[model samples]
Target: MAKLLMDLTPLSYSPALRRIWLGGIFSTVGYSITGVAISLEIYALTSSAAAVGAVGLVALVPLVLGGLYGGVIADTYDRRKVALAATLSMWVLTALMAAHSWLNIHSVWVLYALIAAESLFQPINQAARGAIIPRLVKPRLLPAANTLMMSVGTLGMSLGPILGGVLVATLGYQLTYSINVLAMTVGIWALYRLPAMKPEGTAEQPRRGGLSSIAEGLRFVRGNQVVGMSFLVDLLGMFFAQARPIIPALAALSFGGGEIGAGFLLAAGPIGALTGIAFSGFLKDLSRQGRFLTLSYAGWGLGFTAFGLIAWVFDGQGQGASVRESLLRLSLAGLALAFMGWADALGGVYRSTIIQTAAPDHIRGRMQGLFIITVVGGPQLGTAGVGFAAEAMGAPLTAVMGGALVIITIALATVRVPALWRYVPEPVPDTRQIPSV
Candidate 1:
C-alpha cells in the first residue's frame, strides 16, 4: 500500500560502516559455522532433544551473566577493549572445541562446559556490536544498515549449514570445528582493526554494585513505553516461535537420518532471511514502523502455524516424497521462516532507530547492553522451550503450540498495549546530510 520503495537518491556511504560491516560479515560466518558444527556434533553423539536442550540452558547462564556485566563494562570501560576481549575469548573456546574433537574426547559434559563458557563471552561481544552501530552509520541510514547486516548474516547462515554439512559428513567433526577456530581467528584480526569507542558522555563514576548498574538500564527502558514494548514483543515472539533447536530431532524421527537433513532444515530460515534482507533496499521509505513491528510479529506467528501444518503435509507425502518432498517442504518452511525473519529485521530496524533517537548518549551503551540481553535471551529461551516440548509432545505439537502462543501473545499486545501500534518516530528527510550504506 505504501509505495513499494522510494528512490535511493539521498543515501550516502561510509568507510567506518564498510569496515564494521566487513568485520561483521566475517564474524557472522565464523559464528554460523561453529553453530552448525557444534549442534550436529552434540546431536550425533547423544541423540536426545533434552541433551541438546542442555546446550541452550548451559549457554543461558553465561549469556545472561555476560550481558549483565557486559553492559556495565561497556559503559564503564572502553567498549572496543571489552568487545575485543570477548571476541578473543570465543576464539579460545573454539580452539578448545577443536582440540577436544581431534583428540577423540567426545564427552558431552566437556562440550557443554566449553560451549557455556563461550556463550558467556558471546553476549559481551554482542553488546559491543550493538553499541558500535550508531557510531558507524547515520540515523537516516539505520534501516539500510540493519538490512545490510542481516544480508551479510544471512550469507553466513546460508553457508554455515551447507559447509558444515559437507565438512561433518565428509571430513568429520574435528575438521569442522577446526575450521571455525581458524575463521574466528580471522574475525579477531578484523576486530583488532576497529577503533576504540568511549561512552558518549562524561564517564559515569565507576559504580560499586553490579545490581545498581543493571537496574539503571532497566529503569531507562521501563520509563520508555515504546522501547519497552518493542523489546517485549520481540521477546514474546522469538521465545515462543523460534523452532531451530528442535530441528535435529524432527529430522531424525519425522524426516530421516540426522546431521545432513538437520543442517539443511536448520539453514532454511536464515537463507530465507537472507533473501528478505537482499531486497530490503526497497523498504527505505516505509513509515509506521511501529505498526510494521506489530504486523511482523503477527506474521511470524502465522509463519509458525504454517511451519506446523507443513510438517503434516511432509509426513503425509510418504517415502516417495523423500528427495523432492524434503526439498519442497523445507522450502515452504523456509519461506515461512523468511517472512518471520523479515518481520524481525523490520522490528529491529525500528527498535534500533527508536533507541538511538530517544535515549541519551551517556546511557546508550547500558541501554544497548540490556537490548543485547533481550535479543540473545529470547532465542535461548525458545530453544529450551521447544526442546522440552519436542521431548514431551514431539516436533509437530511443539511447533503448533509455539505458534499459538506467539499469535495469542501478540493479540493481547495489540489490545493491551495499544500504544505500540501508535508509536512512530519523526520522519527523517531524504537529504545529503544523512549517511548511507
Candidate 2:
C-alpha cells in the first residue's frame, strides 16, 4: 500500500532537487494568485471579457520571443545565474504590482505592461530550471522528478486561485500581490544555493546568441523525431481537447447551476490531475513513454467527449433552473472533467520526462525553451479555437467535435511517426551541438 504512494526517491536522493522543488511550490502558488488577481482587476476596470483576455494577447508575443531567446541564453550562460536573474526580475515585478494596487493606480495599461514583463522573464526561468533537473537527478529517476514537479505545479494551480479569491475578498488585491512578492523569496533562495550550471561540451560563441541560436534549436527539433512528436502530440491534445473556455457557459446554460457550477467545473480538472499524480508510481518503470503519451491523449479525448455528451443531453435545461434541479447533471459533468484532467496530467508527466531524458545535454536548455512556449502557448491557442467554435456551434457540440478531432489527430500522428511511438529514453549523443552558421 505504501508503494502505491508517489515515489519520493528523487526528493530523498537529491537535496538540491528537493530545495528547488519546494521553492517551486511557493513560486507557482504565488504566480497562480497573481494570475487571478490580474484578470479580476482588469475586468473590474474595463468590464470587458475581451480586455481581460487581452492580457494573454498582449503578453503572447514577448512570451514566445523570450522563450526562444531565453533558451539561447540558458545554453550560452550559467543556467543557475540565468534562472536567478529571471526569478528576481519576476519578484520585482510582483512587488511593483502590489505597489500599483496599494497606490490605487487604475491604469490597465500599466498592469498589462507588468504582465508582459513577467511573461518575458518566465520562459528564461522555466527553461533554466527545467534544464537543471537532469543535472540534479540520475537519468533513471527523471520520471519521478518530473512527476514531483508536476504534482507541485498542479497543486499550485489548484489552490492558487481559491486562495487568491479569499485573499482579495478579505485582504484586497494589494495584500494578494504582496503575498506573492514574499512567496517568491523562497524560489530565489533555492536558485542561490545551487552550484553554477554551465552548459556541458563546447560552448557556442557569444555572437551566436541571436537569430542563429533560435534557428539552431528549431533545426534540432526538426531533426529529432521523438522530441518533435512529443510537442506535436501535446499541441494537438491542448488545441482540440481544451474545454475551459466554455465551462462558465456550460454551467449556466446546460447544468443550470450558474456560478457555483462554474466554480466546480473549474476546480475539477486540477483536483483530478492531483489524483492522477498521486498514483503515478508505475510510470517510473515504463520504458515506452511514447506509447503512453499517445494513450493518455486518447484518454483525454474520451473524457472530453463524455463531458460534452452530458452537456448535449442537458442542453437548454440549465437556464433558470435551480441548483437542486441541476445537481445531478452538474455532478456528472464535473466527474467527466476530472477524468479529462487526470488524463492530461498523465500525458504531461510522460511528455516532459521524454524530452528531458532524450534530448542531449548541450541543447536541452534550448529544447526546454521551445518546450516552455508549447506548454504555455498551446493552451492559449486552444482556448481561442474552442471559444470561436463554441460561439458558432454551442459549447457542447464544440467540445464533442474538438475532442473527437483530438483523438483522430493523435491516432494519426502515432501511426505516421513510428520513430516517435517507439522512442525509449537512453543516452543521446551530443553530436548535433549548435554550430555557428
Candidate 3:
C-alpha cells in the first residue's frame, strides 16, 4: 500500500525543494485567479467570446519569443537573477492590473496590452525556475520531485479558477487582482533565497546569449535523437489526443445533457489527474522510462476514443429516460475523461523526467524553454484541429480518428527513433561531461 502511494522521497530529501514547490503552488493559484478574472473582465467589456479569445492571440507571439530568448537569458546569467527580475516584473504587472480594475478602466485594448506584457515575462520566469530545479535535486529523484511540483501546480490550476470565479463574482476583480499580487510574494521570496545558478558552460564557453546561442540550442535538440523525440512525441501526443474543446459539443448534441452535463465532463479530467498523482509512488522504480511514457500516452488516446464511443452509443440518453439513462451516461463519459486526464498526467511526469535527466545543465534552460513553447503551442493547435474535425464528423468519429492518429504517430516514432525506446538514465546528475559546441 505504501509503495502504491504518491512518492515523498524528494520532499523528505530536501527542505529547499519542498519550500519552492509549495511557493510555486501558491503563485500558480494566484495566476490562475488572474487568468479567470482577465477572461471574465474581457467578456464583460466586449461581450464577444471572440474578443475574449483574442487574449490568447495577444500572448501567442510573445510566448514564443519569450520562451526562446528567455532560455538564452537563463543560460547567460545567474538564473536566480533572471527569475527575480521576471518575478518583480510580474508583480508590478499584477499591481497594474489591480490598479486598472480599481480605477474602473474598462478598455479591452488596455487589457490586451497588459496581457501581452505579462505573457512575455511569465515564460522567462518559468524557464529560469525550471532550469534551477535540476541543480537542487539528484537525477534519481527528478521524477518524484516533478510529480510533487506538477501535481500541486495542477491542483492550483483546478481550484484557482473556481475560486477566481467566486472571488470575481463576489469580491470583484480589483480585490482579486490584489490577492494575486500578494500571492506572488512567497514565490518572490523563494526565488530570492535560491542560490546563483549560472549555466556551468558559461565559464568555459563564454558564449553570447544571442540568436546564435538560440540557434545552437535548436541545433542540439535537432541533432540529439532522444531529447528531440521527447519534444516531438509530446507535441504529437497532445496534438492528436486533447479532448477539452469537444466536451461542450458532446454534452449537448451527443449526450443531450446540456450545461450541467458539460460541467461534469469538464471537471472529470482534473479529478483523474489528482487521483493518479496521489498514487504515483510506483513510478519511482520504473527503469524503462521511455516505454512507460509511450504506453501512458497511448492510454490517453484510448481514453478519448472510449469517450467518443460511449457518448455516440448512448446518443440522447438524457432526452429519453432522464434518471437511469442520464446517470449511466454521465458516469461513462465522466469515467472516460477521467481516464484521459490520468494518462495525460502520468505521461507528462515521464516526459519531464526524461528531459531533465537527458539534457546537460548548461543548455537545460533552452531545453526547458522549448518545452514551455511546446506546452503553450501544442494544445492550442490540437484543440483547433479537433474542433474543426468535430464540426464535420461529429463526436464519435472525430475522437476515434484523432486517437488513431496519435497511436499511429507514436508507433512510427518509436520505429524511427529507436533510441527513445531503449533509453535509460544514471542515478545522479552528470556534471563531468560538457555540452557539445
Candidate 4:
C-alpha cells in the first residue's frame, strides 16, 4: 500500500501533469459556477423546481451528442487541438451568457439554448482532459492523479455554488457570468501551456464515415468484463440513485431553509469528496479495487438513504419548527450529503483506474468518450428521474426511496455480477524509464 502511494508523489510534480492540473483547475471553477448561475436564474424567473430541472435536461441532449461524436473527434484529431477547441467554445458561451444577462434578456429559453450549445462541446473537453492524464503521470500514479483532479474539481464544485450565490446576491447575474468568462480565460491559458498530445491507439484513418471505430470501442469494453461492469455500475448508480437535484426542495419546503440552505446542502457532497481526496494516498496500495468500488457504491446509496430519512423526519414536524430545529436538521442533512460525496469519489477513482489501466492506447480516446457519456448521462438521467419523482411524491419521500434503491441495486449487482467483486488491480508500470521527449 505504501509503495503504491509513493508512486503518486513523484508524478505529482511532473511537468506535464502540472500543466494539465493548472488548466483543469481553472476550467473546473467555471463549471462550478454554472449550476448556481443557471439555477438562480431559473428560480428568480420562474420559482419552480421543475423549471430549474429543465436546465439540466436542456444540457443533457448536447452532452450525449457531444460525448458520442467527441470520441470520434478525439480519436481523429490532435488531442491538444481537440481540447483547445472545446475550451474556446466554452469561452464563447460564457461571454454570450454574460452578454445575455447584462442585456436583461430575461428569456429563460435563451439561457437554455446557450447552455445546450455549450454542452455539446463539454464531452470533448472531458474526454480530452481525461485522456491527457495517463500521459502526464505513470500508471501507478493514475489513481492519485485522478484523486488530485477530483480534489480540484470538488473544490471548484463547492466554491462555484457558494460563490455563485454571493455573486448573484451581490453583483447580479451579469457579474457572475462575467467571472465565468474570466475563469475560461485562465483555463485557455493553462491549456496553451500544454504540449500537443497524440492519441494512443491506432489513429483510425478517416475513411468516408464508418462505424467500425465505434464498434471497436464497444467491443473492447464488452470483452473486458471488469471495465464493462465498472461503467454500468457508475451509470446505474448515478442515473437512478443520485439525489442531488432534490436539495433545493428539501431546503425550501421540507427543511424550512431557502436558497442559501440549499447551496450548503449541495456543497456538502463535494466537501466529503475533498476529504476523500486528502486520503487518496492510502488507496494506492489496495489491490482489492473491485471490493472498494462495490463498497463505495453501497456506501453512497446508504448515505443518500440516511439523508432522505432525515428529511422525512424533519418534514413530519409540520412546518412550524423553531429556527434552532431547522438548523439542526439542515446540519444533519449536510453530514449525510458529505458521506455520499466520499463514497462517490472513492468509487470514481476505482472505476477510472480500471478503465485507464485496461484499455489499449490506440483506443483509449474512444473508450474515454464512451466513459464520458456514461459519466454525464447517469447524472442527467438522475436529474430527470429525481426531478420527476420529487415533483410527484415530494422531496423527502423521493430521496429516501431513491437512496434505498441505489443501495439495493449496488448490493444486488455485486452478488449477480461477481466479476466486479473478484476484480484485482493490475500492476502499475514504472514509467520513469520512458525517456522524455
Give candidates' CA RMSD values in order.
3.5, 3.9, 4.1, 3.3
Instruction: Give candidate 3 misplaced runs (Cα > 4 Å).
Output: 36-57, 96-113, 164-178, 244-267, 309-332, 384-400, 426-437
Q: Considering TM-score, which of the candidate structures 3 and 4 is the better prediction for this target?
A: 4
Q: Pick the candidate with the highest TM-score.
A: 4
Residues 317-423, model 3: lDDT tens digits = 45534324466787888898889878878877878877766668888888888888787657655755676566666657888888888888988998988877787
TM-score of each: 0.90, 0.87, 0.83, 0.92
lDDT of 4 by residue, 88-170 (tens): 99889889988998999978999989989988998998788777777777765677887777767887877777776667767
* Model 3 lowest lDDT segment of ten: 428-437
- Candidate 2 has a TM-score of 0.87
Backbone clash tally (model 2): 0
User: Pairing residues by index, what is the TM-score of model 1?
Assistant: 0.90
lDDT value, residue 381 of candidate 2: 66
Tell me the TM-score of model 3.
Answer: 0.83
Q: Model 2 off-target regions past 4 Å? A: 39-55, 103-111, 165-172, 202-207, 251-263, 313-330, 426-437
Q: Which window of 10 residues has the lowest lDDT sum in candidate 1?
A: 2-11
lDDT of 2 by residue, 310-410 (tens): 99999988988766888898789989988988888877987887777656777788989999988877776676567667776778998898889989998
Question: How displaced is residue 356 in candidate 4, in Å?
Answer: 0.9
